[model samples]
Target: MEALKQSNPGIVVVWKHKALVDDVYYSNMEVFERVFWTFGPCVEGFKHCMSVICIDGTHLYGKFKGTLLVATGVDANFQVFPLAFALVEGENISSWSWFLGCIRVHVTQRDGLCVISDRHAGIIAVMNDPNVGFTEPRAYHRFYVRHLASNLKTHVRRNDMRDMFKVAAYQRQERKLVADMSLIGQACTKAIQYIVQVPLPMWSLFHDVGRRYGICTTNFSETFNNVLKGARFLPIMSLVEFTFHRVNKYFTDRRELSQTRSEQGLAYSPKVTSIMEKNIAKARYHKVEAYNRRLHIYQVETKRGDRIGRKGGHRHTVNFQLRTCTCNKPRIFHLPCSHVLAVCVKYSISERPWVDRVLQSEAYANTYAPQFSQDRTILGATD
Candidate 1:
């Protein structure tokens, strides 16, 4: 640990020790309780990523059994960007609160941040605690819908009921969410009651004021954990070394990939481009009807056979000036929905301008621009 500090002066490494007395310390082995670390480059690079963070905890299989809590962020291209990690004795309110306090101090110190996590009691308590919590004006907490749905199995085990619960959680508009939840309530009042206990904004995308950037799960952190499966059995310091090299390589590879995509003249990342293409294709089935140039509004009428929303034809209002569609897809996902694309086609407007800046290749490149130092290298850095 001393060597790591000497090598990377900018890295944030925190250690908590069990106290012996006011001025005295416990023995070296007996003192250590928890440790948190964040690479310097990661701390700097996270500024370019979205404000949404996904946090999850995994157990360490090392000789000293401890819990590995990780906080991960999403880049502009929707790729996982690991931010900070901590080694704790267990998953409990005290441990989680300590870890979050470190994150709040060294990492995300800004307002309007959104944190996504599974419905872990420890995490819930830490976020809700008034004295040491992510208060309203500062940060918002969101739950992983997949984890929340798992609780519904106790009340209703049917697949259709589960699907109804998902529909309510995943809806991007409040009216549609109400309609779906009403349907679920009619099917199983117990399931609806269970869901109502959780705040709508925490799990439902429609009501979230913070820009979650379409990230609704802690799967990003879970995926990173899977990548570190083989390293979990190493010694405490060895495990930290393993993560350092793995993350270094991740940034290096992604930086090269972003450069290649830019050279190819790609305006947006591959994921964003694919979504736009799919929406463009769907736009063919809809026809643009009335246009109010003064109001910058257009009415997109769905074909009689179209089946996206309800069965028959439907009319959606599109306001180009506001970059919103009545269907709510564009505003929700920050991409041009089929309805909005139809309006773009009618006006001969380019779709590139409508794409959110965060989805562009420039933002994707910026996310990986920070270089990890190769000179101060860790031994056995490979998986």
Candidate 2:
């Protein structure tokens, strides 16, 4: 946004997860089968920052046992952008769908792209999800190629209508599957009643790529998890919240760094400065048709002595609030030429105050901060 700040103006949030959590919630609660209030907006921030989203899960053996999965994305500069996290019962369609849905709701914008792990069921979950009912002619869902390969692996060894095998497959693939299935079974009929009835999409989001890459074999998420390896784990909520705040902080820092470099380039990097100069001179001031800054208005010069505009002279005018002398420079180059500067200097308009406020960097850094306790190690985690 700093690069094209005027072109696209909007705010974005980013989020991520800490260490893995398994069985964080009870299977009776629904997709997560766990206990906790849903904090989704934080997750959506991550997706908005990174066009690509990565998802994965691990079994938990702590106080509450369940599979903890997380979703993260990459920002414009290809840096990590936090998304959302979920506690589920192993990695499965329901768990994944729930995670995806959380993200869909959390991020505010409706037009950005998405990238997910190469997992078969994730593809299936989005296709088969009932909540994402066929209510519209244009339903948008996307996934990466790696997930299809994962789907193939699990499907390859499966047969039809064998409930036990289904449970066994879940168990075999994920050890905690036994605990999850048992937990769901305890819910009697309400839990399993509508599962199969859910409509799965006919085409996988990345179905075409699976043919070439093989089914069930992409570790983008798994590999990324390593980035958090050995890192101190925090509460699930804290982790998710941290993701969004952190992404914003990173971008704010990056923008500042870019600005520093740009200024340095303006003074020393002729090649870089030339490009910016050309854009300022040619793209902006080639012709004057209307007031570019003013949303509505007509531009005209008063007759001085008074001719409004003379053939051999420049067109001087006080159009809108900007004083554009017969010379055109301020609007075109985002910098005042000698003529306008002369007016400002004569009028004693403090350029220093306006410049600092217009290009302040402190707000960029103060975007958000981790809620640090006087005691850094003492964190209350939301499972």
Winning model by lDDT: 1
lDDT tens readout by residue for model 2, 75-189: 3223344455555556666556656655565443334333444435554556446574311222333334333323433444322222432342222123344454455445433
Q: Please report how far candidate 1 places residue 65 from its true position, in Å.
A: 0.4
Give the Cα lDDT of each candidate: 0.79, 0.37
lDDT tens readout by residue for model 1, 210-271: 36877776678888887788987887678777888889998898899887888898898888
**What's the distance in Å from true for residue 257, model 2?**
4.4
In model 1, how large is the Cα lDDT of residue 160?
76
In order of appearance, the predictions have TM-scores of: 0.89, 0.38
lDDT of 1 at 269: 86
Those runs of model 2 whose alpha carbons end farther than 4 Å from true positions after fitting are 1-50, 61-64, 133-220, 231-383
Residue 26, candidate 2: how far off, in angstroms?
12
